[model samples]
Target: MSSTIAPRVRTLLLLFLAVTGALLAGAAPVSAHAALTASDPRQGAVVDEAPAQVSLTFSEGVAVSDGAVRVLDPKGKRVDTGAPADQGANTYAVKLHAGLPDGTFTVTYQVVSADSHPVSGAFTFSIGAPSTTSVALSDQTAGGGVVGGLYGFARYVSYGGFILLVGGATFVLACWPRGAGARSVQRLVVSGWLALTGATLAMLLLRGSYTGSGRVGDIFDLALLSQVLQTKTGAALVSRLLLLAAAALFVAVLFGAYDRRVRADGTGEQNATGTGDTSAPGAGSTDGGTGTAAGTDSTAGTDSTNSTDSTESQEKSDLAFGLAIGGFVVAAGLAATWAMAEHASTGLQAGIAMPVDVLHLLAVAVWLGGLSTLLVALFRAPSLDAPVVRRFSRLAFGSVAVLVATGIYQSWRQLGSWSAFTETTYGQLLLVKIGLVVVLVGIAWMSRRWTARLVQAPERRAAEAVRTPVGAASARTRKGAKPKAGSGGGDGKRAAQLARQRAAVASAAEKRLRDADPLRTGLRRSVLAEAGVAVVLLAVTTALTSTEPGRTEQEARAATAAAVTPQTGALSLDIPFDTGGRDGKGVARVELDPARVGGNEMHVYVDRPNGKAFDVPEIKVAFTLEAKDIGPLPVVPDHIATGHWTADGVQIPMAGSWTIAVTVRTSDIDQVTVDKNAQIG
Candidate 1:
């Protein structure tokens, strides 16, 4: 059995790894929750003059750090005059220095989202005309680089540990009380506790680096760690550690005190039965003269038996009640840590979303974790009672119901529209998870049916026992029946022999049920399959937490609007040229009045290296829309001034990136052609 089961478990694990790898490889780059939707001056726009301040808008609220918004000039030097200020409505503005140079500038920002994830990005906007810039673009973003990968892995570990810890304990307390004494169950629950504790500590140590610098070395930085502890995420992780300490005590009681109590209770019951059996014959064999004394002894024995039973019953009730309460508090507390610091705390209807998220997490842990515990018990326990499997079935069914209710609410809150289901990464991943869960549910249903059959086996056997012929009983009595020494019809000894015969038959029936039960075997296979799919589902869920929600993506798109629009005034572009000849280098200033999808006026000026007007032998200009493959629309401009040319009715057919090719000839043999891209809108 171990050989067969080992191969199956290995296969399932391999499949899980392959599927997770594929999903991660195909998944879009992980980004922070809050998205930069729009910015003042517009990205890559060339304005006639610089604005007083640079403003930015995001899809959600954010907290700005000191120097969070930095504006750099063409020389890569900071140009922003003051710190960033909040302008409400999820907008922030940073004042720029007065009289800024006429060149491209880079704006880099780093802010914390409301949900405590860091968001960072950079954009470029020109003052008068786009020119060479030395400002390097920032590549830092939330959940990117080596630190992010480690943090993400830690998150997965934490979730896995949470399931094992909660599910194992709940199984021992609610599904199978006797399992507490079993070594397998004891190890399962204890390992869960250890995993959760270690993962929590790892998260705390990595949080500072994850949110600040993407450097692995920064994880040990005392300053960063101090700052992290002051934040909400830090507080939550600390709270989890404290709760885990409490959980450790609970585990000790469960496997130590609780296991001993269950074992002692079983032993005491057996001893009580043996004592009653031995006392019964003595009371019956007494003479009539001592009838009163025998009656008193029997009464005393009856009272003692009742007293022991009552005490045992009360102890069992008290222990069960205490475990239930302790388990719930610890599980709920651990779940709350995630709810208060993740996507649920920032989105729409967050007040209601947080609690719903907690319930959703709890339900997932119970069902998936419980399935693992049941699988181990079924395979290892010598004689697992059918009642334990039945109890877990009911538990799983209830958990699924809760999952459905809370899942729908969460989906609606995050998506906000049906189209998002197919259009966004978060929604697409959600669909995949839903599909896996459906398969898991089907497998669970099959397992439930098998459990029902297993539970009915005892009843069927009892019915068969009742239907046995009277001749069979007579045969058994004739084969091994012997009257005891006491001669009064030998009724007591014969009754004892019949009781022993019944016990032997029951033991044989139980043995047959354990060794030859097809239902148990079927249930184990179904549960194993369920667990395999559930592992994949959990991976998808972890990915979803890092993905940007569909509603936020949609809102960001709407806020940014079109990338280009018709210019209200003449747009100017400075294009530099060198013909590789003596005194051939010059700058061309091209102007398009009202650059849009229609006819527009244009002007071109050629200036020498010393900023003086210079005359060229010949000049030519044409426009091409490379995206649409429309090309080489020639513009014949007549020379109106030295180093100047003008044209009218230069038609632009559409809105897109258009290449303006310029040809200049300083001499017959010295000529060059240069192309510049311009947005025609």
Candidate 2:
């Protein structure tokens, strides 16, 4: 591999990554259940009749599998209701076993939103007389729109950048093998380091977003940061991962420097124990040495004691090279894991408590990191010498062992029941990944067999060379070199045979050491290719870990839609929530029934003499969104949607408080209508 990679090959690697980025990048939000329109018995309105059952209705259908509604009396006594089920696609109902006992009742329920988030909200409605005591869900806008958007965008970019960096570098190292202008393979290592850094920053940003931290400006503001940090669900998971990453980085820096020193020594062996003397008996230490006996087995064996010292020096300079690769894989997996988790569950605990996920991550890192290290060695090894082969084989074996162990543990953890193997997505994908790993192991085994075979060949040849030629030539030459005086046949033939054997052994030894032989090069490339496949498999594993292990259930309940909006006396309020028609779109339409619920008297006010548009200079109107910081838009029209916003469409853009200021200030009375700003799709 070359130090400077070719532009085209680099471009292709980058292009592939860019595409993967697009796949994982944030798509538009999907529309989920809209905000609660109106709860029957209207908050606090006491009714004389005892209802048979309690029901809650929404703007859209509630997912029955993950949705539930509960009715509680003021004393916190639960009312008996047949399993709370979705009455209509949009209405959730639970038949109460007992009725009467008015005071105040609270309907608390949670729904598994289409976006995969478990969202819960409660509303209080009185059974008999309305209660004065009431409660509202507390909400705070964590940050400004610009800050939040940048935060999410930065996270995505970091993830893309990390995957691009590692996957790209590894691809170059394995597939392109010194493509075009790259004079050496070191460039891949450099690229890997840069990418790992990008991933670290990304993970950090991800933590910030999920935890709802606004900015560094809020770090010292413990009240704010703590709010984000103390959140049991996301906070623990994000914090632990951040700490782990920081620890990993610190280790990487230290080990990277150490790894360089090892490479710089020019020994060609990572753990070589040197004897120091050039003419020592240790020359064939591995018995057919590469690094152990510096010049014993490589093509450059006779160059000088530990001759490629400079080449080793270069390896030492490449710090964090392998770790960079590991970091990339780890980061990509974590991001995908968290993103999907956010989609599927509400609290972070559900996602974090999945021990299988943690094991899956560890397994991926070991496999990917080990494969990268092996690949670098594959290119650097000058020959298929036993010592070099053994070293790599040992390292490869360790990685394979860890991968197998972690994989098995993960499988057991995720698929607890035997039937789960074929029943769940987690099971099926795990099987596929496991099958691929088996194949990879088979290939590695074959390589190991070849290396071991090569190790025994030299001694076999040395013995044959000494004995076979002598017997053959003597059989032929005995007749030709026969002397009348019987010229010392035995001694002379023996001497000649010995000389030939010496020459044969020397030739075999010479062949063993050729630094640039085609056969050696081919073997090196082959091993490299094997390692490359190993790395790719690792990336795939990472992807798998990030995916959800199940398909959403299709069964839906009976649904009913109730259109409700705020009422300011009478007039009419109509809203067409436009979720830009595109991927990740989230559109909301709030239509107030009659555009008002009450407050309209039989008489007329100054806002409008008749039930017509009141001609006023400006119709000052203000309304509050149920939740602050609406968060990311869901796959469906959902309240916790990201990039949430609200705006005035018509005359309501101006800010102020006004009451029935009906005046013909505007030239046209029809132009006095107003619209509010809603969250962007």
Q: What are the models' TM-scores?
A: 0.72, 0.39
Candidate 1 residue spans exceeding 4 A from truth: 1-28, 81-83, 138-141, 278-299, 459-515, 562-681
Candidates' C-alpha lDDT: 0.79, 0.43
Local lDDT at 212 for model 2: 37
Expressed as tens digits, the lDDT of each residue in 1-681 for candidate 1 is 545655564455344434544555323246577777667777888899889999887767887866889999999999997778997657799998898989999998887787777888889999888999887775656557877766666666777778878988888898998898887677777777777788778878888877766789998888888877888888989999999999999999888888877877887787677676555555555456776787688778777877887788679879889989988998999999999988888867778989999999999889988887887787667368889999999999999999999999988887878999999988998999899889889999999999988888655653455335333664575465534465675687668787677766755555555656677778888988888788888889777877788877665554344323445677788889999999899998888888765568999999998999989988888999643346688887889999999899987654556899888899989999888998766
Model 2 worst lDDT window (10 residues): 553-562
User: How far is 199's C-alpha from truth in model 1 (Å)?
Assistant: 2.0
Highest-TM-score candidate: 1
lDDT of 2 by residue, 376-441 (tens): 444442222455455556655775676677566555433545665576554566677777787787
For candidate 1, the TM-score is 0.72
Q: What lDDT does candidate 1 reach at residue 532?
A: 79
For model 2, state the Cα shift of residue 348 in Å: 16
Q: Which ranges in model 2 have alpha carbons more than 4 Å from their true place? A: 1-197, 203-227, 232-360, 380-389, 418-423, 453-536, 550-681
State how far residue 437 of model 2 sits from its true place (Å).
Answer: 1.9
